[model samples]
Target: MSIARPDLPRRLAAEALGTAVLVATVVGSGIMADRLTEDVALALLGNTIPTGAILVVLIMVLGPISGAHFNPAVTAVFVARRELAAADGLAYAAAQVLGGLAGTLVAHLMFEHAPFALSPTVRTGAAQWLAEAVATFTLVAVILGGLRFRPEAVPMLVGLTITAAYWFTASTSFANPAVAIARSVTDTFSGIRPVDLPGFIVAELVGAFLALGLMGWLLAPRKPTTVPVATPAE
Candidate 1:
């Protein structure tokens, strides 16, 4: 028996709820890590693992419903590929942003912090911008490549990519616009200053576009070579 596909509303809900949970995990873990450790490396390690783990869980659970595009950059790429309509992409992005903000609020409430506060953390400069771009490029590349080569492994690939990116990239790979925006509201270990949002967002978009272009060509199917059949001499 064939299963019925999810409707648009269900898809939107999945996108929103998935993004909310993802952001909540990111912010909550960061807060917990910050409070538990004075050592920056330890705090970062604590923050990184949960974020990666949650991505795997969220993607596996919500992927069928909405493609699990918790990131606007990913949504944009889908739109560009004509896999998703522009209007639907806009709606998805709105839901994602709203849900992400709600997640930040939820995290803060659980931690007894203010409902909303602008981050004081200063993340800026050319190196940081370059890092954000590189981080997002690698993230989108991994996603596209994984989907092409091993669709079943995408969730784990994404999770592992982010986990490694957190340690290697200077910006800690806030490669998602929704997550970046949500994170700007909390002055915690994962927060980025509001002023820095523009740069990071721009860099992320640039990176995503680059990945789409490169991966589109790389993953494209090539025309099979035609061979002339030789007739046997009778």
Candidate 2:
């Protein structure tokens, strides 16, 4: 089956727009949750659901355009797999980062907060890094596995995986570097400290590479072996 590959400009626009909406959903939900409740757990729940739902919507709407790679780590994996050109992948990453920042600004405007503020949320340490690695590994694995087996279900698979990871991981599964960087400018429930960004981004990249390596082999088609037929009374 032939898939329609849009021009580079349109693909980049889709990526940027999709990522913008995704981060806006994340940041806006987090701010709203923080204000609506004193319980941290409840606020987290509020943030997780909207983020997941928006991922589903965004991927469904934009996947056909740019493969909906809102995360730089994911884009890198595709480039490594030879599915996307290096230049286009770089462009996608740039758009995603800019879109993420724009999303943060939009969320802040909606809540009447300052345009940009450094986050003081201290999220660091070995445990946090390990959690990020695991979260990103699982996220990439889910994407690859879904594409391998059920191309139609990738959106739901990603959304559900992220929703679950939000609760399971220590750093709340800031699995996407672009989103993590954008969140650093917000002092809200979903924000991470700028100082800790390196660890998370490195871990995410490591995890993505690991998943690509493992899934590349695991999902490959196995050659069928022919059994030698036994001669009947020969």
What TM-score would each prediction reach against the true structure? 0.96, 0.97
lDDT of 1 at 179: 93
Most accurate candidate by lDDT: 2
Predicted candidate 1 versus true structure: per-residue lDDT over 116-195, tens digit per residue:
89999998999998998999999999999999899999999999999999999999999999999999999888888999
TM-score of model 1 relative to the true fold? Answer: 0.96
Clashes of each: 0, 0
The alpha-carbon RMSD values of the candidates against the true structure, listed in the order shown, are 1.2, 1.2
Report, for every candidate in turn, its global Cα lDDT versus the true structure. Answer: 0.93, 0.95
CA deviation > 4 Å runs, candidate 1? 232-234
lDDT (tens digit, per residue) of candidate 2 on 41-71: 9999999999999999999999998899999
Residue pairs with backbone overlap in model 1: none
